[model samples]
Structure formats: C-alpha cells, structure tokens
Target: MTLAPRLDRQPRSALLTVVMSIGLIYALLPLVWLIISSTKTQESLIGSFGLWFSGPFALFDNIAQVLSYDDGIYARWFLNTFIYVVAGAGGATFLATLAGYGAAKYAFPGKRLVFAIVLGAIAVPGTALAVPTFLMFSELGLTNTMWAIIVPSLISPFGFYLIWVYAAESVPTELLEAARVDGSGELRTFFTISLRLLAPGVVTVALFAIVATWNNYFLPLIMLNDPDLFPLTIGLQQWNLQAVGVGSQPIFNLVITGSLLAIIPIVIAFLLLQRYWQSGLSAGSVKQ
Candidate 1:
C-alpha cells in the first residue's frame, strides 16, 4: 500500500509541468521564429522551414534594404515614432504624475467624483473609443496629422490610476508637511522632493506610456492617412499588405527584419531604466 500510495499525485504533478512547458513554448515560439526568419531571404521564407534559417544569411542585407528602400521611408517612420513617444508619452506622464499626486494628497470638492469618472474611464477599452475619437478629431480637422495620435496618447487613464496609488503609498506625508512648514511652494516641493521619491513610479508609468504609444497601430491607422506620418507599426503593416497584394513586389524579409529591429529600442529602454522602477516601488516604505 505504501509503495503504491503516491502514483496518482506524481502523474498530476508531471502533467502540470508538461502543460506549463507547452504553454511557454506556445508563447515564445513566434518570437523565436521571428529571430530565425530575419536571417532569411524572401525566397527562403516561402521555400524553407520557418523555424530554422535557410539560404545565405541575409540579416544585415535585409536590414540594409529595409533602411534604404522607398526613399528611406522607414527612417521617417522611426523618427515619427520617436517624436510621438516623447511628446505624447512624456506629456501624459507629466500630467498623470501631477494629477495622481493631487488626487492622493489634496482635499477638494468633487474629488471623489472626478476619480470615479477616471476609474470608469479606465474600464473603457481604447479600441472601443477609437471611432468616437476619430470622428471628433475629423470634425476638428486634426485628422491626417501627428496631433491626432499625440493628443489621444496624452490622455492615459491607466497611467493616472497607477500614479494615484503609487503617490498615496510612496510619497511621505511627513516630508510634505515639513516642506510646507519651511514655506516651500507646492510646485517647488513637487519638483524637488516628491518627484525624486516618485522616481520608480514615474519610470514605470513612462515605460508603460511609451510602449502603448509605440505599439499603437489601430489609433494611428484610423487617424493618419499619410504614409509619411506613420509609426513603425502601421508602416510595417502597409509593407505586409503590399507583399501579399497582386503583382506587388514581395519584401517579406525586409518587413520581418524591420519589425525585429523596431522593437530593439524599447527593449533597450526597459533594460536600462528598470533599476529606477525598483527604487520607486521601494520608496516611502520606512519612516524615522
């Protein structure tokens, strides 16, 4: 009886491990394939195994073609994306930080109502609002312009929510009280003291806003018709469509390679700035 006691439990454990491994592979397989496929040529993509490289290695060649093709349009797309992220995400983070701090620290009439609206807004999906946003922008004649993308990006409900919670917990009330006693203005205290402590949360929110703006395809696709104003996501999709279109030149390798290259900057940013996130999350945990 003792010898046969645990056979069923062992099978369940083994099954769970197997299922988790399969799930991980399912999630990571596409990324692995992208890395492999980027090394291939267009013909090799159609004729060769997808998960492995075939034909002469063309990673650098594909990158060169992607950069040099279409009058260096991809470069413009990169620059556009950079500008959008900086202006849009940067503004959103600034607004969210101040609003969240105010919500957490100040007492004002209708404050709870305002937060209620913001929380309700957080539950609303961006895609669902895209149509209304587009129509509103169209009326304002902001369509087909960079502002269409940037304006919407500057209104991040989720960022506001995150910083609200972070500011409440991470910012010390004692520090603010002391600053007030020293006759420091609210703006001075925010910029000098609170902002320093809010570092981890600020970095976290900025990273989120940047990623959202960077990967936003639907918004830009709906708002801007000009190919020159396209971000990398829309630009890549356009290339993808042209590849599949009748009698169009197939540049599958360049498209795939461009995508892989497009993501590297975000990855680099996260890697370099994550240290601040750790410190921010740890802020105001201890008091004298």
Candidate 2:
C-alpha cells in the first residue's frame, strides 16, 4: 500500500508564513516611519531618510510645540475629541445594546421591516449620506456646531448588528424565562441578569463605536467650519494644510507628533478591552 500522508504534514505552510510576515511588515512600515519622522527636527525631517532617526532627537520638542502652538488650540481639540468619543460613542453603544437586545429577544410589530431598514442602511456608505446630512443640518441650523458631529455619530448600524448576533447566540432563552417567572420586572431582569451575560458583546460594540467616533473625519469636515470645535483629526489636518499654500509655514514635525499623540489613546483602549473582544468572538465556539 502507498504510504499514508502524515497528520502533521502541511504543504504551503512555509509559503503562508512568508506571506503573513510580508503583510505584517507592510502594515507596520507607515507607523514605523511616523515614529522615526516624529523624532527628527523640522530641517532634519526634510533632509533625512524617512524610516530612520537623524540629527538630534526632537520628539519631545515637537510634542511641546504641538500642544502649545496657536495659543494651545491643540488642547481644545483634544478635549473636543474626548467629548465626541464620550457622547457619540457612548450613546451609540448604549442605544445599539438596547435595540439589539430587543430585536433579538422580543417580537414586535414591523420588526422584520426595521431589520431590513437597518441592513439597507449598513450597506449604504456614510459618504453617500454626507451631502444629504449636511443639507438637513444646514436647514436645522446645526452646522458648524459640535452637535453636527456628535449627532450623526450616535447612530452605528454595524455595532447594532454585531450585538444582535452576539446576544442571540450568547444569551439563553431559558434563563430569561426563569428570571421572568421569578417575578422580576423586565428592566430589572435585564439589568441584573442579561446585562452581565452581554458584557463581552457590549464591550466589543463599545470599542467599535469609540474607534469610529474617534477617527471620524469626513462628516466633521463638512459639518464644522469652526476651528475651535475641531477634533484631533480635523485639527491635525489643518496643521498639515498650512504647509500647502503660498507663504506656507511647514510644521510637519508638529503634525507628525500630534498624529502620534492621537494614536496613543486608541491603542491603549484596544489593549485594555481586547480580552472582551476576543471573548465575544469565541463565545459559542465550544458546545457543552
């Protein structure tokens, strides 16, 4: 008889490893360049190789300039970004959790129609709605205001869908019924029992919403004309643009430093919440 193939044998394992290694390097190149570029002084930044440090280290100097330039407007932008993420992302997470739980557990009139609408909305890119949203906000006199940015960000279709799927699978119907039979009111049962079970899913959705709101650029660009109301994304972009026009003052160092600062909070959030995200992904993997 012909020899049987070994159970541990894998064809193309080396090829797969090589491909993944290349992808990892490709993904990291820009971030590495940004870090190296941020450490260089303005003159050195323009003259030196992008991926390596050159001359004296100016990372601390660049950070100080980024925070203090234009009468400390960057601090205001940082505060504004914090507000947007707290209000917009926090509200989105809360609302999506409620809606997703209700949709998964309750039978209501027009439920299917509502799901259909949400699915359609998810399929439509946010850019496609930006013009209409701007026009509507303009009519309502909300443009150039923080409300313009925060309001639209409060709706997250993808977060809703993720929670819906997670909740449906992770929460047991019998447990809910048992709580109801024990004379617990719906809200009480949900708060005491269901919410605990849904922690991973909720945290997963919250992270998604937070990241989306934090990185939001296009809607804020169209909605807010006031630099005072700018988030870090818009504020950094303004600094980048200053280098373009006539009589331009290129503050590339500030822009690079500010970008690095903006990335820190998001990275920390992911690091802190990754356990919940991973648990949510693997929730139903094993059968009891």
Candidate 3:
C-alpha cells in the first residue's frame, strides 16, 4: 500500500494545509450551490434542497429566458457593463501608469503632497465620497448618464500607488537615459520602452479597476435613475426586487442563470490575462 506523506516532521505545515483546504471548500460551497440552483426550474428551486439537484434540468431554458426577457434588457446591461469596464478601467489604467511612472522617475515640486493625497484617498471609504459626488454631478447635469460611472472610475489611487512603488524599483533610470540619448521623446520612450517593462503592474491595476467597475453597485444605484442605463449589478437587483414582490412572476431561475452567465466573461478575462501577468512579473524579476 502507498503511504501518505509523513506529517510528523511538520505538524504546523500539515495543520495549515488542512485549514486552507477547509477554507477553500467553504469559499467554493456557495458557487457550487449557485451552479446547481441555476440548473433547476423556479418551482424546483423553491421546493428542492439547495445543495443538490432538485428539479428538472432547466439550465438552457433559464438561459434562453434570461436572454429573451423584457426585450432582452440583460443584453443591454451586459453592453453597458462592457462599456463601463473598458472605458473606466482602461482610462484609469492609462492615467495611473502615466502618473505612477512620472512620480517614480521625475523630480518635481509638491510631489510628496501628491503622494500623500493619493495615500489618503486610498484610506478614505468610497461611499464617503458618493453623496458629495452625486450632488456635484447633479449640478453638472452628469447624473443618470454613462459619464457618471465612467468619470469617477477613472481615478484609482491604489493602481497609481501600486505602479509608483513598482516602477520605483522595477524600472531602471539607465534605460530611460539611453532612450533620451537616442533622441526619443518622452511619449515615445514611455510607449515603446517603459510600458513594456511595466506590463505586470499595469495589468494588475487594470484588473482591479475592471473588477471594481464590473461589480459596482452603490454608485450606480444612487447616480442612475433610468433602467436603460443600469449595469448588470443594478439591473439584476431590479429583477430580484420584482421577483420578491407579492403575486409577481418569480424570475428566480432566470436571475440565477443570468448571474452565472454574467460571471463567465470575468472568469475568461482573468484566465486569458493571467499568463501575460505572470510573464511580465517573471521578466520584471530579472536583473537589468
């Protein structure tokens, strides 16, 4: 008989492994339930056991209904989410990269104050700024518009900070001096040289910003009043509200299925981008 690895020599390591395995199961249990629940019909979902398959398989049916419901509003929400993530996260990443690289490399006045302010912003809760932002945007007539979502998401203190710390160490001054000596402009040097080296940090920041924008609820809830402009977070919430109302057509199945589908893109994005992130990190680790 094959023997298990000896744990007597490292009890703490074995204990930690056991604890982490339990934690992993705990984290994954809800997702497993969601998958099983989503495959069941609305009636079965209500009557059947939550952790196991209870009703007739309605996964495809549920997906079809989710796609077709209310003139396909889910499609619109998906598009809106795509736009918000792309524009908001992309803009934030670009700006963060520029600011971070500049801060790390350049000598300037008030740089410390700028860094301090960014650090302070990181400490402040996002919700604390929501009401004031709403008031300001309301005055500017930007509320209930895509700009409301996109504009605020453009600022990522953590992204900037991450890149700043990373660039200060990962990027070398010698390379930049060489570029300058070769008569390359700042923009050219950044695009051709610095950006490639900063890929991992940039991708990390972009992913963070993308997730924040994708899963954003509170800001969208307060800023937007129109259903047409709602992202998946708000749109799904509206469906949940309708489902819970007295004598309402229970769309619980559709909601669950839609939610499962909604997460696919994000999962795919992470999977697709992870190799690049890893390669960048690996490259960054090498000595110049």
Candidate 4:
C-alpha cells in the first residue's frame, strides 16, 4: 500500500517539477536575453544569436555611454524615477493604510458607501483616468512638474483595498479594545499597537505601490512634456525614437542597457522586502 502511494505521488511530483521549471524558464528567458544582448556591441546584436554573446564584451562601455550621453540625462531620469517611486509609493501606502484601517475598524457614517467608492475606484483602470488626470493637471497648471506625477500616484485604490482586507483579518478587535481600555488615545493605539501588527500588510501594500509607480509610463508620458522631467520609461522611449530616426545611433545598445539598469532597483527592493512578504503570509497562523 505504501509503495502504491509512493508510486502515485512520484508522477504528481514529477509533473509539478516540470511545470515549475517551464514557468521559471519562461520568466527568466527575457532577462537572460537582455543580459546577453547588453554584453554585445551594436553589430553583434544584429548579426549574432539572440541568446548568446558575440564579439568583445562592451557592458562597461555601454553603461558608460548610457550614463554620459546627452550630458548624463539618463542619470536625471534615474533620479526622477527614484523620487516618484519613493514619494508617490510611500505616500500612497501611508494614506491607504490609514484609510483602510478606518474602514476596517471604525464605525462611521457612510462607511460602507466610502468603501464602495474605493472598490469602484479600484475597478476602474488607471489608463482610463489618464486623460482626465492630464486635463485636470493642465487646468491647475501643474503639468510637466514632479507633483503632476506624484499627486496622481498618491491615490491608489487597490492598495487601500488590500490593506482594508488585510486589516480586517489580521488585526484583533480585542487588542484595540485593550489599548483603549488602558486609556490610550485612538491615534496612539493606532500608531503604536495596531501599526506594529499591520507591518506585514503595510509592507506588502508599499511594495505594490512602489512597483506600480515605478512601472508607470502612460501617465507620465501624458502629463509631462519636458524631457528633463521624464521618468526612465518615457526617457528611454524618447531615446528609442531618436535612435530609429538618426543615422548610426547606438539606440539598441542604449535601450538594452537602460532597461537592465532600470530593473536593478526594483529587483533589489523585492529581494530586501521579500522577507516581509513571507512573514505576512505566516502572520496570525499561531496563537500567542
């Protein structure tokens, strides 16, 4: 009987392993191509195999050119991306956490209505709102400014919804009540007691916000026309456009190198914050 069970499990395990391997390959294939292509020169990129390296490695040279081109404009784009990601994502996470906690824990007038609105907002695609957002920003004379990007990014309905769901399930009513009974103000209780418990959820929401803001292209593209104010995505697109039009432009190399550089910060962030994700998954599993 044990042998029969083992034999049955073997096929299932093998199938799972195969599926996982396929998925991993699919995910990593593009990154591998990027790395290989980044190492190759412009001629090799066109003439050589897509997946393999060819000719002299020009990784350092390509990186240098990417940074030094156009008076180091790529560096400026990098800085703008950092500002948007940090300020926009961080602000969005904070507002979402506060709003979510209120929606989850407190009884207020029209609370359900407020949550419904948030849900509706979450359902609406951000792309759909870009035109209207641009119009509004233009009206307010905020277009082509950093605030134009940061302000719109601050209002993340999905983050709020995630935190709302997490807060309801992960936080204990009794704990808040105990803190209140101990004469702790609501704000203090929220900041000290509840916030600590919500750390995992907060981290998860922040990661989502950061990734969303970092990858955002269309909104910034529409909002800001100034090349100097452009984020990496839009700036890279501009470079790509220039490359296509001009004679003997190193467009392909710049695109590949810039893309690789753009992804580094996000990868580092996920690696560092991944522990919080694991902890969040395991939270509330064991009773204290």
Candidate 5:
C-alpha cells in the first residue's frame, strides 16, 4: 500500500503580505498617476500634486480633444495599432503554435540547430536586430510600409519556445497515436485534437504577442516614416515631441489623456483572457 504525505496548511506570512502590498503599490503608482493626471487641465497638470486631482475635471474635454485634435490622427493611429496587433501578434501566435507543436512532436533533421538558433534569438534583444532588419527591409523596398512591422513581429522565438514546452508536456503522444490509428490525417488531428489541448498555451502566447506588438515603439519608429502609419506608441510620442524645437505647442494634457485611453484596450484584453492565462501558468503545477 502507498502512503500519502500529510498536508498541513500554514499561517500566511505577514512579512510576505507586506512585501506584496509594497510591490502592488509600486506597480500601480504610475497607472494611478496617469489616471489622476488625465483628469486635470493643462495648467493644473503643471501646478498641482501628481497624485491629486486639480482644478476642473477635464477628462471628458481632454478625451474629446484627443479624438478630434489634428484632424483625428489619434483615431487613425488607434486603427493602425489594431491592424498591427491582429496581423502581427495573431500571426506570431498561429505560427508559433504550429512550429512549436511540430518541433515538440516530430523528429526532423536540423532540429537541434533550430532549437539552438531559437534560444540564441531569444537571448538577443529586438533592438539589436532592428538596424539589420531595417537595412534588409530597405533593400527590399519594404521600409516605411506596414509589412516592415508585421513581418518582424511574426517571428517570436519566446512564444515558439513556450508552446514547444507546453505542447510536449500537456499533449499526450498516446492520444495522437490513437487519433492516427483511427485514420485521422495529421492536419485534421492537430486542428481537432492538439489545438484544444494547446488552448491555454495559445492564449498565453497570444496575450504576450498582442501586448508586445501593441506596445512596440522602436520598430515602428524606424520602419515607418509616414505619420498616418504610426501606431499609438509612436503617435503618442509625436504628440509629446511637439513641445520641442521651433513653433513649440505643448499639448501635455492631451498626451496624458491619450495615454490613459490607450491602455484601456490592453487592460480589457487581460481581463478577458485572464482565465486562460492563469490556467496556462498553473497547468504544470500538478503531476498527472
């Protein structure tokens, strides 16, 4: 007979709780500041304490300005960002899911080489590759185009690695063999069987990819010169930059309010996908 170990629940640590509370405050401080600052007028922003509301609440007024200012370029930027996230992040997740599952399941030539290359790529920051990528795209006459952003975003080594590990552990080889014995084609089996098991991993990778692509600044800044093609990150920076050089017109309040509005979608995405993300993270906690 096998004996199970006794499980004892310990009291929660006060020190740990305090540390977490401090970390929570640290993380939320900037967002709180952004929210509060967004409600202030231009002069109130410069005049008042950062954490408190000052003067009249101009959040609605500022939002109106953000949506209407400069012929509503912010709206266009938001649309561009949405397109990039859908194409770039969505493609990255799909390709990563396919590649990772293949790598985890199949034995192919140069598999180790591919793994090594992915690990090396993950170690290298995107900024390091930005210049080389720009030069390559420029040679292909693809610079200043949306493809410049979307194409690079598609190659997510980290996402691929994540799915590879997840698929190997979470997906059962016996189940795959059973499907094959039942005469299911590889494509059909993967789509019908493997994909459902990979759902949590897929959602986690998608969220990461979406956030990365949505918040991408350096890539778009170098790849696109056209203001109309700018995502929210670059567009917001442009608005902030208006304070510099000759004929300076600082719309600091609009910048603050725009920033507040910009983060809403990402927060919404997290809230919507939180369940899947949590499951993905906790999936490996217990041995099956």
Candidate 6:
C-alpha cells in the first residue's frame, strides 16, 4: 500500500518537472537565439544554423559598427532612452506614490470619485489616447521635443493603482498617528516615515514606467518627425525600412544589431532592480 501511493505521487512530480522545464525553454529560447544571432556576421547570419554556432563570433565588431554607424546616432538614441527612462519613470513613480498615499490614507471629499476616475483611466488603452496626445503636443509646439514623450509618460494609471494598494496595506495607520503625536507635520511624517516604508512599491512602479516608456514607439513615431530625436524603437523601424529594398544598402545587419542593442537597457534595469520587486511583494503581504 505504501509503495502504491509513493509510485502515484512520483508520476505527478515527474510530470510537473517536465512541464516546468518545457515552459522555461519556451521563455528563454528566443533570448538565446537573439544572443547567438547578434554575434554573427551578415554572411554567417544567413548561412549558419538558426540555433548553433557556425562562424567566427563578430559580437565586438557588430557592437562597434552599431555604435559608430551614422555619426554615432545610436549613442544619441541611447541618451534619449536614458532621459526618458529616468525622467519618465522617476517622475511617474513619485507622483503616483503621492496620489496613491493620499487616496488610501486621507479621508477627504470626492475621494471615491477620484479613485473611480483613476480606475477608469486604467481601463482606457494607451493607444486610444495617442492621437489626442499628438494633437495636444502639436498645438503646444512641443512636437519633436523630449518633453512630448516625458510628459505623457508621467501619468500612469496602473502605476497609481499599484502604489495605492501597496500604500494602503504596507503602511500602518498607527505609525502615522504616532509620528503626528511626536510633533511631526504631515509632510515631515510622509517624507520620513511613510516614504521609506513605501520604497519597494515605488521602485516597482518605477520599473514598470521605465519599461513602458522605453518600448513606446507609436507615440514617438507620431509625435516626432525628426530622425535625430528618435528613440531606439523608432530608429530600428527606420533601419527596417531601409532594409526593405533589394539593393546594396544592406541595412539588415544594422537592423538586427540595433534590435539587439535596444534590449540591453531594459534587461540591465530589470536585473538590477528585480530585488526591489521581490521585497515589495513580500512587504505587501506582511501583517501590519
């Protein structure tokens, strides 16, 4: 009887292990292919096997060419990405945290209405707002400017919701009351006590904002006509356009290399900040 039960459980465990392994491969396969493909020359990229090494690695050369191409415009795109991610993500995180903390902790008139509006905003797709955003930026004479991108990225409804839920549950009401009793004003208490407690949630929202803004293409594409002001996403699209002709332009190499470079910042940011994400989730679950 003991042997029979053990055998049945073993099959279930074995099946689960296989399923998890398959899922892992499915998730990582494309990334592996990209890494391999980025290391190959144009001839090797076409002639080589899809998943295996078939030529001398040109990783360094490809990177050099990508960085040096078109008077080092790729570097400019990189700088633009840094500006967008830092300003967009950092600003959005701060605003969202304040809004969320206010909604959750304070008892004020029209609070419910404000919360409803935020939820409605979250339900609305970003793409739906792009046209209006373009028109507004155009009217303000901000088209083709960095502000056009940064301004829109600063308002993230989902980010607000994340921090609101986090602040409500992670921050203890008694702590705020005790701080007030100690002669700390609301602003001081928020800056000193609540903000530190909410750091993990803030970091989580910032990461989401960074990724969203970094990958934003349609808005930048529509808002900015200047190729010099393009982010990596739009720049890559331009390379793809150049690659379409059957002549000796040979922009396929640049397109592939640019695509690979575009992914680096997001990957690095995630790897560095993922610990905060873990800490945030755990903090949210802890008993207040």
User: Which candidate leads in TM-score?
Assistant: 5
Runs in model 2 deviating more than 4 A are 1-12, 284-288
Whole-model lDDT per candidate = 0.91, 0.91, 0.90, 0.90, 0.95, 0.86
Ranking by lDDT: 5, 1, 2, 3, 4, 6
Instruction: Give the distance in Å from residue 111's predicted Cα in candidate 2 to where it truly belongs.
Output: 2.1
The Cα RMSD of model 4 versus the native structure comes to 2.9
Tens-digit lDDT track of model 1 for 9-119: 643488889999999999989889999999998988997888987898999999999999999999999999999999999999999999998999899999889889999
- Against the true structure, candidate 1 reaches a TM-score of 0.89
Misplaced by over 4 Å in model 4 are 1-11, 246-248, 279-288
lDDT of 5: 0.95
> Model 5 reaches what TM-score against the true structure?
0.95
lDDT of 2 by residue, 199-278 (tens): 99999999988998899999999998899999999999998888665676868889999999999999999999999999
Write one digit per residue (lDDT tens) for candidate 4, span 195-250. 98899989988988999999999999899899889999999998888777757476
Clashing pairs in 4: none
Q: Assess candidate 1 and give its lDDT.
A: 0.91
Lowest lDDT block of 10, candidate 6: 2-11
Judged by whole-model lDDT over C-alpha atoms, candidate 2 comes out at 0.91
Model 4 steric clash total:
0
lDDT of 3 by residue, 1-288 (tens): 998998777546888899999999999998898899989998998868889997688899999999999999999999999999999999999999999999999999999999999999999989999999999999999999999999999999998998898788778899999999999999999999999888888998888888899999999999999998999999998898888877767898888898998888888888978876675456546656
Clashing pairs in 2: none
- Judged by lDDT, which candidate is best? 5
Which runs of model 6 end up more than 4 angstroms from their true locations?
1-15, 246-248, 282-288
How well does each candidate superpose onto the true structure, as a TM-score?
A: 0.89, 0.94, 0.92, 0.92, 0.95, 0.91
Model 5: residues with Cα > 4 Å off, grouped in runs: 1-8, 244-247
Q: What alpha-carbon RMSD in Å does predicted model 3 have with respect to the real structure?
A: 4.2
lDDT of 4 at 86: 91
Q: Model 1 shows how many backbone clashes? A: 1
